[model samples]
Structures are given as C-alpha cells and as structure tokens.
Target: MDAPSGIISAIVTGLVIGVLGRLVVPGRQAIGCLMTILVGLIGAAGGLAIANAIDAAWLLTLLLQIGVAAVLVLITASATGRNQ
Candidate 1:
C-alpha cells in the first residue's frame, strides 16, 4: 500500500477498533474521539506485533487489537482522571 492509502487505512481501522473497544468496556469512557483514535492506533499496532510474534489467526488478531484498545482506554481514562 502507498503512504496515503496506508494512512487512511490506519485511520479507518483505528476508528473502528476504537469504537469497538469503547463498546466492550463496562461503562462510559471520558475520552474524546481523538484520544480514542490514538488509543486504537497504538492498540492496533501493539496487537499486530504481538499477534505476528505469536502467529495468531485473523480473528485472534482482531480480538487482541480490541482487547489492547480496551486496556489502553482504561489506562488513558485513569491517567486523565476522567474514568466514569
């Protein structure tokens, strides 16, 4: 993929993963869209790295991504003192 498409893909993936992560969480989060996207991007990258290392399947990879995003969301919320 080219740079532009890769960037766009990353944003789209981040938005989806971020929303999924937020939904999976037990309660409402105090973070905004941008924070969620950032969390999602980091989570996706981390999850991909771990998945690659472990040779995880596609479903497992996605689950890992969402799980990582959820964890990050929790951390971010706590760090910001806005967990609700």
Candidate 2:
C-alpha cells in the first residue's frame, strides 16, 4: 500500500487498538474518546516511522502500531498508578 492508504487504514486500525490498549493497561487515565484516538494515531505514526527505519514490511506496520499503542497505554497506566 501507498502512504495515503497506510494512513487511512491506520486510522481505522488505531481506533480498535486504542481501546484495546486502554482496557489491557487499565488505570484512571480519564482520557476521553477523542483523546484516546489521538494517542493511538500518534502512536501509530511513531510505530510506522520505526518500522520504516528498520525496513519492516508494510503489513508489519499494522502490528507495530498496535504493539506501540499497547506499550504506551501500559506505561501511562503505570505512571498514573505511581502518582497515586
């Protein structure tokens, strides 16, 4: 897929991943739905960049985005936990 296609698909995929991430890494993030989507979007971009750097296949970027989003969610959850 081309750049635009990747981005479009990422947007859709990221939404699901974002919610899954939040549920997996539970905490009082208090993030609204829009904010969660934003975080997922950013995380997907970051993941894609890293994938490009490492010459990862296009299909892998999809997986990368989810993995990164999950990690970010987990980290954020842990951070909030520590703060409390």
Candidate 3:
C-alpha cells in the first residue's frame, strides 16, 4: 500500500481497536481519544508482531491485538492515575 493509504488504514484500525479495548476494560479510563488511538496503534503493531512470530490465525491475531490494547489501556490509566 501507498504511504497515505497505509496511514489512513492505521488510523481507522487504531480507532476501532482503541474503542474495542476501552470497552473491554472495566470502569472508566482517564485517557483521551488520541491516547487511545496511540495505544491501539502500538497494540496492533505489537500484536501483529507476536502473531507473525507464532503464525497465528486471523481470529487469534485479532484477539491478540485486542488483548494488547486492553493491557495498554490499563497501563495508561494507571500511569495517568485516573482509573475509576
């Protein structure tokens, strides 16, 4: 994919993954949309790395991505000291 399309796809994926991660986590998070998107981007990248290493299936890859995002959300919330 081209650079522009890749960036756009990443943003859209990040938004979906971030929201899904937030929904998976319990209670409220103190992070904002940008932070969530960042977390999602990182999580997606990490998950993809791990999945590639393990040769995981698509479903498992998605689950790993979501799981990573959830952990990131928790960590971010704790770091911000506003997880309720």
Candidate 3 weakest lDDT stretch, 10 residues = 14-23
- Which predicted model would earn the best lDDT? 3
Q: 35-71 in candidate 3: lDDT tens per residue?
A: 9999999989988899999999999999999999999
> What TM-score does prediction 2 earn?
0.61
- Summed backbone clashes in each candidate are 0, 0, 0
Clashing pairs in 2: none
Instruction: Give the least accurate 10-residue stretch of model 2, judged by summed lDDT.
Output: 75-84
* TM-score leader: 3
The 0-to-1 C-alpha lDDT of every candidate, in the order given, reads 0.93, 0.73, 0.93
Pick out the ten consecutive residues of candidate 1 with the lowest summed lDDT.
Answer: 19-28
Residue-level lDDT of model 2, residues 1-84, one tens digit each, is 899998788777668768766665645566657756766887777788989999999778767877788787766556656413
- Compared with the true structure, the alpha-carbon lDDT of candidate 1 equals 0.93
Tens-digit lDDT track for model 1 on 24-67?
88888989999999999998998999999999999999999999
How far residue 7's Cα lies from its native spot in candidate 3, in Å, is 0.5
